[model samples]
Target: SGTAVLTPREPGGLPHGLRAAIALRAAAAVQDEELMAHYRARLEACPGGVSFATFAVPGTMPEDTRLAAILRHADLLTVEPRGATRDDIEGLKAADVTEPDIVRLAELCAFLAYQARLLMGLRLLRNA
Candidate 1:
């Protein structure tokens, strides 16, 4: 039997790498200790590398504290207005994501890819 490959339904949305990174991070946040241990064990058994972290519960903590914790763990942080338009990009350009920040983002992307590959391998092994 052969598995069928599905084509994308849309274009110019979030990248696959970014989506995978988001999913991996969310999975790490599962609160069950048994599940967490299972993930850890599977990750260790897998050939590729993957990393996991438990994100702090939101709203239960102060906004600044939550932001700080995420910043400490995140490789790249994206910020967009709740409702933004083209003109908003200009306004945001001056205030948000400066040149040095972009450079840092590139590095973050690379690191995230490495982590995703490791994690994906582990997840697959677990499913197997």
Candidate 2:
């Protein structure tokens, strides 16, 4: 399911490269090096994925307004999801992000968070 999220059959407005970059960003936010490497590999496999590579770094923002909006929303969802508001959606819309793409972004972020937590739990158990 996570792989599907990253590389959907019909990726809509979000391409595979962008999806990998977003997933990489979320993984990086949690400081999960292994997960980061996983996403990095996926990103490398994607055509033109390197253009979206900046997003993998937590603080790096894009010059493109639409991409900047996406980075902001991805950061919010990854770092502090509880604080997300409708205004964030409005911001994305203002940047020309379509409604379906917004939903796709949310799903990607949510799945990465879940994957991060699962990885953390497994690490803790292994050391226990």
**Top TM-score hit:** 2
Measured over all alpha carbons after superposition, the RMSD of each candidate to the real structure, in angstroms, is 12.4, 1.0
Residues 1-128, candidate 1, lDDT per residue (tens digit)? Answer: 00010012321222223223333443344333443454455444433323222222212222443223333223223222134344433333444434443333334434444444566778889999
Off by over 4 Å in 1: 1-92
Q: Residue 15's C-alpha lDDT in candidate 1?
A: 27
Top lDDT hit: 2
Can you give the lDDT of residue 66 in candidate 2? Answer: 95
lDDT of 2 by residue, 1-128 (tens): 88678888999888999999988888888889999999999999998799888777888998899989988999999999999999999999999999999999999999989999998999999999
Candidate 2: C-alpha lDDT: 0.91
Worst 10 residues of 1 by lDDT: 1-10
